[model samples]
Target chain A: MGKYLSFSIIAIKHGYKNKGETIARFAFYGIILLVFSSLWNAVGSEKIGLKPRDMIWYLAMTEWIVLSYPLIHTAIQEDIRTGNVAYLLTRPIPYIWVKFFEGMGTLLLRMLILAFAGFGFAYFITGGLPTNPLGLLLYFPVGIFASMVVTLYQSIIGLFSFWLQDATPIYWIFSKCNFILGGMMLPLDIYPEWLQKIAMLTPFSSFLYLPVKACLELDASLLLEALIKLTVWAVIGLIAMQLIYLRGVKKLNVNGG
Target chain B: MNLKNNYEFFTHLLKINLKSLTSLRGAFLLQATFMIINNLVFFTMWWVFFKKFKSIKGWEITDLCALYGVVAFVFGVSVIFFGGVRSLAKMIDGGDLDVYLTQPKNTLFYASSSQSHASGWGDVVSGIILLWFSGYLTFGSLPLMLTVLFCSFVVFVCIGILFNSLAFWMGPMDSLARQFYDFVVTFSIYPQVIFSQFLKMILFTVIPGGFIGHLPVSLLREFSWSNLGFLVVGSAGFFILSVVVFNRGLKKYESGNRFIGVGTN
Candidate 1:
């Protein structure tokens, strides 16, 4: 636990050191927010019961969730490709734990930076934050759990690199699934009934939609349901990651990587 | 180079790129397949949106489909023909300009066309399907549609080169360059009516997302000679600007002491 905490602290320092890249990324996020705010303002005016400010706030939260997660798959894939995974295995701590802690550290810092920037953008555009401040505060833990679930899923995709020469296409497909089914651009409530039903059944919604919805609306029942679903999904993701990791390591040992 | 020589060089580069891409047929097919699915899923979001709201500011499901088709087709054509535009920042930052400098050919043209992406075929297929399904594929509109597509392709490639050329001055700015490219592409897929006047102005001039994505679709939907002329002139201007920028940036490029053997792959 202490080792993992230390890893997280080191990763946070690394993120702080890379302030230039973070600032550039934050600027890009601001542009994206500006575009989306304009889009929602225009579209919401046409649609019934759609408030542009609320939708923009929802988008701010969802985009923060999307951008907060580090691209752990890319690092893992590179390690496997370049035979660095063998060196990683020799470390005192388990490779997966190291990755998880480092990823968490980076993700926490990035989330704060992006969330602050995103909220500031939203406030500047919409002139206020969401009305449900308590809900927003409560959403931090749920968001963290959701990020872990996504990380585990990405780790599974990365583990596939042990077998496939290039797992980029597979990762692309997974990301598209998250973008569409997860409702990154728009809330799932706005989707058709059938599409909403399908999306709700998938774990993708738990990643962005559920968290954003909780932040904006603060529905106790909905939050409870989302928490339960997210917990289940996180467990499933962890099991999948562990299974894949074991098989990948076995293959690597046999192949002398 | 002369026009004829340039045409011949482009064709030769296209052939090499295509051959290299097809060298691994299975991987190519997988990539193309996944890209098609990815695009279809993206379209589904709009499909769902239109199903609920019917239309936003006179832009219907079919219009959105056409918008997607045009943007996807333009993007596909650019990546397929001049895929290296996608990696221009990385190349510039890695000092990969050494080989291009040694050659007598135009550096920007050669660098931009040096690679081809197989997934572009998926986009082309999905885009044509969307255009046809949206009833944009009429005999009367075919010429106009093709013209819009060609102009959009020019604008797309120009935007890519313009952004990626920043690496020559900013060092290895892979993420920043990519985000700008992605921003342009994302803004292009939406209806032009969604933007306010200020946003619309930015789209046309600063980012030129409007010229590449919005204006082309709008021109195709309603054939206005004036708008078409604007698009033509805008695309030409952007293309010339990109070339000028690339030339200026080339003077600042310092080799990173990396040996890149030609034809090694």
Candidate 2:
């Protein structure tokens, strides 16, 4: 656990050093919020049961989770592809936990930046803060847990590199699921009842929509539900990662062996 | 190289890329399939949006479909043929341009087309499907659709090169280039009516999202010589600007510093 904490600290330092990527991410985040704000503004807040400002803020929070998600899968893919996993396995700590903590560290830093920037920009665009300040406060922990679950899923995707030539396509599908089904751009209540039901059944909404919805509605019960679902998903993701890693390492036929 | 030679070389490069991708049939299929699903998933958002609101500022679901069809197809064309555009930043930053500088062929053309994206095949298929079902595409309008698609493709490629060339001036601009490129993509899918005049100007000029996203859709809806001219001129202007920017950047490019290769496998 201490080693994991150290990995997290190292990642934060590394992220600080590589501020260029953060700026780029900020620019993209700003652009997405700006564009979507315009869309919602044009759509107007009628019959949707949420104000345009709320929708924009919702998007900002969701995008924060997505934008802050560290691409640990890419690193894992590279390690497996180049057979560097062989060297890493000999380390005292497990690779999956190391990656999780590192991703959490990176996400922590990125989430903070994107949170301040996103909220400020969304405020500027929508001309007001979220109606519920307490929900905004609750966003901190919920957002972090959401991102942690995302990191575990990314680790599972990365572990697949042992068998697959390229795991990016799988990552792409997962990402789109988070975007569309997870309600990144809009609220799930706006979706068809059937679609909303399906999205709720999956863990996608737990990471994106439900948490933001909880923030928008200022409901602690909703927040609790979001956290509970996120924990369930994270546990499932961890188990999958462990099983996949063990099986994949068995197939690890590095060169010169 | 001459025009004919450049055309022949590009075709040959494309063929080699296709053959290489098909050689790994499983990976290629998986990638293409995933990309198709990705597009559908994104489109579902709009589908759900329109289902609730009916339309946005007079733009119906079909109009959105038409807009997305062109955007997706053009994006697919750019990545499929000019896959180098995606990695131009890394190549410039890493000085991987050394290999291309020694070649007898046109550096930009060869570098851009040397690789291909198998996932773009999915986009191509989905674009056709969307356009076919949009109720706007007909035999009579097919010629115009093709023209719009070509112009949109040019805009996509030009935007890619224009952003990528920044790496030559500001070292290692992969993220910046990608984000800037996303600016165009993110703006292009929405209704043109959503933006104000000032934002529209930025989309038309700075980001050039209008050339691919707005102008083409409007022209398809109501044919106007001025709008069509704008699309053509915008594409041509960007092409010229991209070539000039890339050439200027090439002059500043330092060689052989890149430790690793930067393009597709």
Candidate 3:
């Protein structure tokens, strides 16, 4: 509908107006990563074998991935906490679609500001970026698609609020577990072998670590397979998400706050 | 000037914070979860590095765990007692100082002690587990009695106070300041074994990152009476400095004098 399209545009405009926040968030990430990069580089430099540049490049990719964190977590949590979620049900637009799109709009701004800036700034700092420019360029779209996979996951988590008094405890346990399994703080390779193998099969790493690995690693024999697996996960996640929205709407006190 | 009044005031503050926090169990737990997730992530990094290097700059994974226990224990204690450390910028900017000032207790005491975090208990528990695990894994659990534990807790509170004081003047965007504090934590997460001498200096004295986790690492490596003394003096000094700065800032504060909590009319 025309209203839906216009609403999304307004959200983007409102979100991007805080340009200083975007810059500050990037700088925040930069300060943390720079210190971390230097430490890792020094650790690597007392070399068993790995190069400082490898640490630099790995951190650079992780920086961008972290900046492009999926928005579904914040979006769902905000709606549940503020109880403004009731506002969406009476409107002409679909509640799930509007929230999903609004989250995407904010996420788009993050990608442009943090991810794009990180890639550029990282290159300047380390003297080289991702080895495959074309593959990396292709990563942008795949990254967007992967975030939606996570949006579905978040929606499922948020849906529990409708039935439970408070979902935060549950959310915490799950998110913390996901953090280690998803490579939010460090790469999946860092986990013990059993955990690493387990993390690979799950969709959490698909959301953050895989794409970073795809673009950052110069080896291309596995790139096509990575994209294909991502596409498959995207389809499965979106379907489950739509089902959750439908079921969640049936339980809402749509006319009440 | 009266001991009884001060004791009564502190008790009353503790009761209020306990009542507010116990009712909202989930929210309080969520805060601690974030802290725990942060620490666990760092641990994972050390696990990976130790796997390959075996002994990084003469520091093993257990040494890293020892470092973790100090930072975690200190950070956990601060969140429990000095809850206002995170609330400084918002309280100042939003003019919420009016309520605390009008209340018949010390404003700084009220701010720091009047809050509770249930989730912080998780970090405290995790800190214990990590400490227990780290010691058992490393040196078969030596004699670290009550005195050392008390001094370590003091050191944590001092670091937190020092960092929070920086927010008094940083205005509304104190997240940048908080990140810098986290930056200190991140830098200190790794073993100091591989650090350049210059980096070690920056950690030990400049940013005081070494004082946080690195000192505990050294203590774990070689416990001495001197380290205990350092913690006592360092923590006391940091706390004194924080209180001094806070009182000085109060002379310059401009209150917003309005409620900014959820659904404030």
Candidate 4:
């Protein structure tokens, strides 16, 4: 655990070193918020139950989780593809946890940076913040846990490289699932009841919808429920990763040295 | 090379790319099929949106479908045929241009067309299906669709090259190039009616997202020779600009002697 904490600290430092990429990401994040806010405003926020301000804030929260997602899957894929996983397995620490901690480190930095930048952009675009300040405060832990689950899922996809020729397509489908069922763009409240029910059944909602919902309104019961569900999903994800990693390593084939 | 020779070489390059792509038949099929499914899943959000609101700013669900169709089709064509366009920045930064430079052909086209992304086929197929279902594709409009698709494809290629070429002036800025690429694609999928006039101006000019997404969809929605003419002129201008930019940047090229895949397979 101490080593993992060290890994996260090191990753945060590494993220700080990459200032240019971070700046570019923030620029893109701002642009996307601007575009989506314009669309919502054009649609007339009154038509929907929510205000344009809330929607902008919701999008900011969701996009923060998504944009901050470290491509740990790609790293894992490359490691497996280039036969570096064999060398990695020789290390004292578990490779999967190390990658997850590194991702958490990067995700923490991104979430922190984007939290400030996203808030500024959303506030500028919508001219206000979410009405519930406590909910806004709660978003940090919820968002981090949500992103950690996403990291685990990404690792699971990367581990599939043991059997599949490429795991990118799998990642694509997972991301789109996050977009649709996870309610990345619009809140699931507006979705049809049937779709919302289906979304709840999947772990996708725990990724974005639940976290952003915390910011929409302050409800202690709802936040507690969301945390429980997210915790459940995280446990499931970790179990799945362990199973996949164990099976995958058994079938590993190295091409060069 | 003359026009005819260039055409023949490009066709040959595409054939070789396709052959290599198909060599891994299972992976190719899986990637393409997954992408088609992935795109459809993405559309579900819009589908839900339209289900509730019906339409926004005179843009119906069908119009959005057509918009996505055109954008997907053009994107697929560009990436599948000119896969290297996306990686041009990395190639430039890694000094991977030596292979293209040593080739006895148009270096730009050769560099851009050396690889194929299998997922593009999924996009192409899904795009065609979306257009058909959206009622935007009919025998009378096939010619217009093809023309607009060609123009959109040209703009997409030009954007990739122009941004990737920035590596010449600034060293190894692939992430920045990728951001621009994503910005255009992100801006292109939304209805143009949603943008403010200021943003619209930026869309049509600085980022040129409008060329790849809006103008083409507008022409398809309501046919007009003037709009078509404008698209043609715009695409041509961009094409010329991309060529000039790439050539100017080539002068600053330094070889890192990196080991890059040269399409030998």
Which model scores highest in lDDT?
4
Query: Which sections of candidate 4 miss by over 4 Å?
Result: A253-257, B258-265
Q: Distance from true position, residue A159, model 3, in Å? A: 3.9
**Model 2 lDDT per residue over B1-265, tens place:** 5799888888888999999999999999998998888887888888888888888999998999989988988888888999989999998987788888877988898889977999999999888878877877899998999999999999999999999999989998898788888878988888879988998889888988899878898988899999899889989999999999999989999997443454534
| Residue pairs in collision within model 2 | none
The per-candidate count of clashes, in order, stands at: 0, 0, 4, 0
Residue-by-residue lDDT tens digits, candidate 1, A1-257: 99899998999999998876788778777877887776666556336355777777777787787778887778788888898999999998878778877888899999888878987888898897676767667777777778878877776787777777567778888887788889988777777778789989999998889877876788888888888888898899888888888888899899994
Find the candidate with the highest TM-score and give its number. 4
- RMSD of candidates 1 onward, in order: 2.3, 2.4, 4.2, 2.0
Model 3, span B1-265: residue lDDT tens? 3789878887776678777877676666565666676566546756766776677556777777777776677666666776676666567666677778877777877777766566667677677667776763234434453344555565555555556555557556555546556667766666666566787787755466666777656766777879867856765676687688878777777867454552575
Scoring only the A-chain of each prediction against the true A-chain gives TM-scores of: 0.94, 0.95, 0.81, 0.95
Best-to-worst ranking by lDDT: 4, 2, 1, 3
lDDT of 2: 0.87
TM-score value, chain A, candidate 3? 0.81
TM-score of chain B of each: 0.95, 0.95, 0.81, 0.96
User: Pairs clashing in candidate 1?
Assistant: none
| Candidate 3 Cα deviation (angstroms), residue A22 | 3.3
- What is the TM-score of each predicted model, taking all chains together? 0.93, 0.96, 0.83, 0.97
Q: Tens-digit lDDT track for model 3 on A1-257?
A: 66666665776797687654665677667756566565665556335343555555556555565555444555665776677777756787777777666666666667766766667666776787545556567667766666656655665666666655355555665565556667765667655789888888877677667776776664465556667777787778678777877777776665243
C-alpha displacement of A142 in model 3, angstroms?
A: 3.6
